[model samples]
Target chain A: MGTQAIRFVGYIFGAALLGLLALPVTSLVGAISVQKFLAGVYHPLFWPAISLSLRTTILSIGFVVLLGTPLAWWMAHQTSRIGRLTTVVVHLPIIMPPAVVGVALLQAFGRKGWFGTLLSAQGLNVSFTVAAVVIAQMTVAAPFYVQASIQAFKKISPDVWVVARSLGASPIEVFLRVGVPMAIPGLISGVLLAWARALGEFGATLVFAGNRVGHTQTLPLAIFYALESDIELALVFSLILVLVGLVVILVISQW
Target chain B: MVDTSLIVQVQVSLGDFMLDVDLSISMKGRLAVIGPNGSGKTTLLKTIVGSVYPDKGHILVGDRVLSDTKLRIEVPVEDRQVGYVPQDYTLFPHMNVINNVAFGLSTGGRRGSRACKKEIALRMLGRFGCQQIAYRPVQQLSGGERQQVALAQALVTEPRLLLLDEPLVALDMTSRRVVRLLLQNYLSQLDIPTVFTTHDVRDVVSLADSVIVLSRGKVVQMGTLEELQKQPCNDFLVEFLGQQ
Candidate 1:
């Protein structure tokens, strides 16, 4: 093909893909009248879902950062086979179907699942609860944070750590003082990505947490419920999620 | 008799290469390690600083046993009191020059307030003619300034031993000569043993009293530069000495 023809074809393909991706968001926003959008905002399920999503996603990301940071640091330093295997295992959630993740969570923490009997014996039931919602979000979102964190930590030259240690800083101190500060920008981006993932988590939460108004129903779950009864409410939820995602992307770009 | 201050006997296997080295240096001695690429020069320095563990070995600096495989005593890197400057200097990019130098004082067992540490760091920088750059961010400094800051950072800790990996390799030719003289002067005043790796013959001639030649992972020769030149070990060494 001629160069001009090839360029024209490339533009067509690129624009087509862009349009396909933009369609759902534009359609959602375009469909909403200000009256309908405000009515959806005032719906009883709206505030509960928003509050639950904010609470659960915040808790989930907090746990992810706390646990995943150290884990990523360890993984980044490993050169052995076990380390590579652990990396693959950590990333499995990102590729695994969210429904499968829900099922796995059920198998691990559901009343009839692996830890169920033991947990129940201690008078603790985790299935279909607000805590379950957080667990589901964490399961689906932890990998994003961990993956980004691994890259962040790995970018640091090994020499920096050695020099820090040689300067009389302990391993923990080196990690906190040198590693964390060096990796802060990458870590912040990771947190934002994980927060966005947790905010938009749906399939796993629906299956694991069981959508219930004011209790386990998060924004995504509420959107699903709203879609069945009122499409306008779903659009409102999606708009809010899109706005949150945009803010995250903006902050990440600043870094 | 010169008092022996540093002793390293270690065996490490890196993939297909094996680094089996045994050496001793006297107090305030400066030893330069020279080798081709992949010859384990940096690895030797790393082993001394407790960054890389040897398969079976012991490292002793002054009276402290930094590592002993048989005795199962391995002093962590922080407690080794060995200052190191890697090839790139690897200054902490997050902090300013004074803070970078003060890091050791604040984090180590030194009992000093933050202000006290900064004062000491600034004093050390002043000694290196870098006091003006104390508040400047590390990333904003030139290559020569980075070297001075790194040196100040390492020296401010009052380490028992110092290891420098290719200290002047990153500098331009003009700055290289300038820093070399600066290094020679400062290193002369230091009472502790100093070990540096360099491919440059000028660095070896000016800074080190003794030289150890490495090939693949083994030491080919260890003696004064004049002694090595009198009887070269391999073609690489012959060519290396020819540069002199």
Candidate 2:
């Protein structure tokens, strides 16, 4: 009964949140107007964010995959208690809200943060630069990659992995040839989700990288920047972001 | 003739149940590990397959020393080539028939690796008379077909040793009889050693060349089917016979 009540409350909260969010969703969708959406696609800011977002998203995904795949595999292969603890730590950022991620990044990478001071001492101007965008994107987005990867590797029966190894595959080959394909569904889901998260990274980028046009203004940050002057333009950017998210989500689901 | 002599010594405890396995099997040999539910038969196999490590002892595959807890010489499973058909026949549900077969081979950056008439998966299927299920999802295959696919999958890798856990236990009697005969015929044609575990007496008498009777985790007896039948060692063997 308690579980049911909790679920009931969850549903109520979800519907209320959806109702509140629906305006932004509709504004985002409506800003398109189909015609403006197409023309908006040709906007200088629009294409730049799209291309930059695409490039950075791809790069971030690549980085996550390179680092995260091995970590996930190691984590999944573990049966010890420490392994379980590590998995919890790895998934912590994924469960955190985007705003918290931004705030955390701000404290850590902002001009006053620890790394910021070190970099400043070294005369490295990383703040409010393109690199800040990548860092902000990575902080908020990398966990999706790790989480997806761990789940993917976990889904593969250890039996298959053992068999693959016994059959003469090196650990690397087993991961590349067998592990990757076997866990493609989870792996791709992780990549697309992480990429999407990175593409639409806002709070972290805004707080850390600032809403500088053509530099760190990814689609989400661009939407916020536009909202200050033109709510319709903000909605237009948001509409495109939602469409891209939907398309990527659809693709990920199919995989 | 390939020398398929096998020897394994292992000791481990899982969830309050202790297991100690010590046995030897020879070329063209069929050893049936007979035991009741939760008697560590699967544990023994998993240890051999390299998924689980024993606390002590060694497994010698031909001249190669596969495991020794003292020296920490534990060979990884990808190098072991011990084909196992787990009880449930956990076939890849997402993959189609041929890809599942190809999973056994090296494809050199290809999607489907075992392309060598990976359809011999088909021949193995044809042996089970399931050639018509070439494209069907394993999830949709009947229990009998699933057993056939599992056997075919285990065979496709051309493993030197085959380990079967309750291969025929899941089948209906009719399917069991057919599958049993097919397996026997196939095994007779090859010299590779095979070990199967089951509580079914029919499984012991029908397929096993020798039997290792395990009760409460220890080997109580080891011999031919007729030998066990002729001299039922104790109440356990007698009761085992009666139940079977």
Candidate 3:
């Protein structure tokens, strides 16, 4: 083919792909009027799903950061076979199908499962509860944060740590003052990515936490339920999620 | 004989390479270690500063024992009171020049408020003619300016021993001459023992009182520059000192 012809064909393909991605969101926004969107916001299902999603996602992100930071730092510094194995293990969740994860979580935490029986003895049941929602979100989102954190920590020069120590800064002092500040930009972007993943979590949560309004029904679950009775409410929830994902992308680009 | 203020006897296995050296140095003058790349010059400095632990042997600076593998006593890096300026002058990129210098005092809880620590850091920068760049980020500094700031940061802690890895290898011709002269004047006035690694012969001629030539992680020769010049021990030394 001629160069000009090839260029024309490339543009056509690019435009088609962009249109395919943008059409769904645009169609959803176009179908709902401002009045319908505002009315959907006041639906009884609206507040419950929004509140549950916000609460569970915030808690899950907190746990992910607290637990992932140290693991990433340790993994960044490790050079052994164990370190390599840990890296593969950390990435497994991201590759595994979400439905499979839900099933595995059930097997581990269900009443008949090993830890489930132990917890049941203590009068605690984790299966299909709000706690199950948080756990499912955490399971799927932790990998993204940990992987990003490892890259951030690894980018730092080893000489900086040695120099800080030589200047009389303790190990903890070095981590807080030097390590955290240097890695802040990467860490922020990582948090945003993990938070977005947790917000949109569907398959795993649906299987593990069941659909119960005002309890385990997050924004995604509410949208799934609303599709049967009211398509307007579902469109509103999707638009909200799309806006949030857009804001995350814009913020990450700043970093 | 001068009193020995620094004693380093170490044997460390670094992957496929092995570093073995034993020496007693007086605090009367500075010592320079010259070697080819991967000759373990930086490794020796790291061992003294307690960054890289020795598999065997002891390191003593003044009256303090920094490490002794036999006795199972290894002082942590922060407690060693050794100042180190690495090859690229790895100043903390997140902080400005003054904050970088003040890190040692502020983090050590050295009997000073934050303002007082900054004042001390500013004074140290002034000594190196770098007060103008105190508030500027370290990323904006020129090569010569970075060397002075690194020196100030290391000195602000008032460490008993100082180690520098490739102090002038990163500078251009003009900045090299300027930084070399500045280092000569400043290092001469300090009383504590200083050990620096270098590739330039001018650094040894102008700054070091004695020299140790290393090859394949072993000290091949140890004496004054003139003595090494009069009797070159190996081809590496002959080529290094430009005696060929």
Candidate 4:
């Protein structure tokens, strides 16, 4: 083949890969009528699942920011054995299978499991509870926020922090005024990714939290439940997730 | 004019290199710390500003003890009340010029409301003749303007001492003249002690009243430029100065 032909073939190959990924979402949308989609959206299962998803995802993001910010700042600025180990541990969830995360949470927090037994003895249970949904979501999503936060904090030159300190800005003041503002765009991207991950969490929530409507059944779990009985409800949940994902990506790219 | 003196006796180890420097200068204007690369000039400035802790000894500015290793008293950077303008300016890119300058005043509750702090920042920017670009973002500024804003940011707190690290290193020749003259004018007017590091002899000649030359993390010579010209401490000093 000629050079131009080779280039054209390569372009088509790349586009074909991209189209394969996009086809499911577009075809799913095209298959459903607007009226049916809206009706499914307003279904009784839909509202409860969405409310649970929103509650759990928002709380997970809150925890991630509160806990992950300090971890990221420290990890990015220091170079110790502990810091390196923490970085590796924080980044593992991004690549680890969600099912494995679910299994791990189950074994660690089940009624008869370690710490779970201790908690259960004290009249508390973590597995198969609403709190388990939050915990599972956090376990799988907090890493995304923390890893991105580390990158964000690292991008800012330490010299700026040094200058802020020299100018009499306290540690907290420097973080709030100088560090956070400088890395806002990256941090926002991290937050969006974490929230989306938590919203779409399935395997972990299913195993650890269990799919119970109005309790632990999030949107993803609702979609799973709908798959067995009503395909239309599942399609609506998938569509909402697709739209949200698009909006998030659009906002992040603009920022 | 009340005399302001800075006494530093510090010993620090920097990765297989020992940096021991002792000096006492009653600073009226600018005191230029001129040295070659790897001479620990920047380290000394960092020690004074509390970024790098000394393994031993103490630093005193006027009557205030900034660091005392023996007594286990070490004042943090925020409490030192020292204005620092680092090399390359390092202005907060997220803020505008006015806000960067205002950061020094408004932080740590030393200043009042935002409006009140901004008023002071505007006057400080006006002093440096860059008040027109006060609202411009720092990332959009030219090198010289960034340095000017950095200086204004450092000075807004009315600090007891000033530490400038290579203020002219990043500027082009055209802007270097402007920045140097601006710095000279400001240094001459400020009564507080000032210590600035530079490699250029011209900077030391025009901006500083006394010179401290460093070699291999140690002070090799300390005297006025006139005195150094009369008697060179060693061949390194003479060769580094490019004079007999």
Best by TM-score: 1
lDDT of each: 0.92, 0.77, 0.91, 0.89
Instruction: Give the winner by lDDT.
Output: 1
Residue lDDT tens for model 1, A94-117: 899999999999999999899977
Can you write out model 2's per-residue Cα lDDT over B1-244, one digit (the tens) per residue?
6555678888877878888989988877999998777778888888887888888899877767778988899987766767788877767666776556656665324345355556556676676567788888877887778877777777776777788888887888898888787778777776678888887787777788999888777788889987898898767678777756
* Better model by lDDT: candidate 3 vs candidate 4: 3
Query: Second chain only: TM-score per model?
Result: 0.97, 0.89, 0.97, 0.95
Summarize candidate 2's per-residue lDDT along A1-255 as a digit string, tens digits.
Answer: 799999999999999999997777775565468777666666677777777777777777788888888888898888899998987877777787767876777677667787777877888877687777787788777788888888888877766665555445678887887788778888889989998888878777777777778877778877777778877676678887888888997998788
TM, every model: 0.97, 0.82, 0.93, 0.90
Instruction: List residue ranges in candidate 1 displaced over 4 A.
Output: none
C-alpha RMSD over true interface residues, each candidate: 0.7, 3.1, 0.7, 0.8
Where does candidate 1 clash, by residue pair?
Answer: none
lDDT of 2 at B26: 89
Per-residue lDDT of candidate 4, residues B1-244 (tens digit): 5565898999988778777999877857578897778889889999999988999999999899999999999999999998888898999988899989998887787848889999999999999999999999888999999999999999988888999999899999898988898888988899888999987777888788898888888888888988887897877667757831
RMSD for all candidates, in order, please.
Answer: 1.5, 4.6, 2.4, 3.1
User: What C-alpha lDDT, on a 0 to 100 scale, does residue A202 get in candidate 3?
Assistant: 91
Question: What are the DockQ scores of the candidates, in order?
Answer: 0.87, 0.36, 0.82, 0.78
lDDT per residue (tens digit) for residues A1-255 in model 4: 999999999999999999999999998889789898899888999999999899989998999999988888888887889988888888787777888888888888999888789999999999999989999999998998988888999999878888999888999999889888888898999999999889889999998899998899999999999999999878988899888888888988987
Error of 1 at A92 (Å): 2.1
As a whole number from 0 to 100, the lDDT of residue B68 in candidate 2 is: 90
Off by over 4 Å in 2: A1-24, A27-44, A95-125, A249-255, B1-4, B90-158, B230-240
Q: Tens digit of lDDT per residue, candidate 3, span B1-244?
A: 6688899999988899999988777975589998889999999998898878899999999878999999998999999989999989989999999999999997766687888999999999999999999999999999999999999999998999889898998999899999999999999999888999998888999889999988888898999999999998988788878932
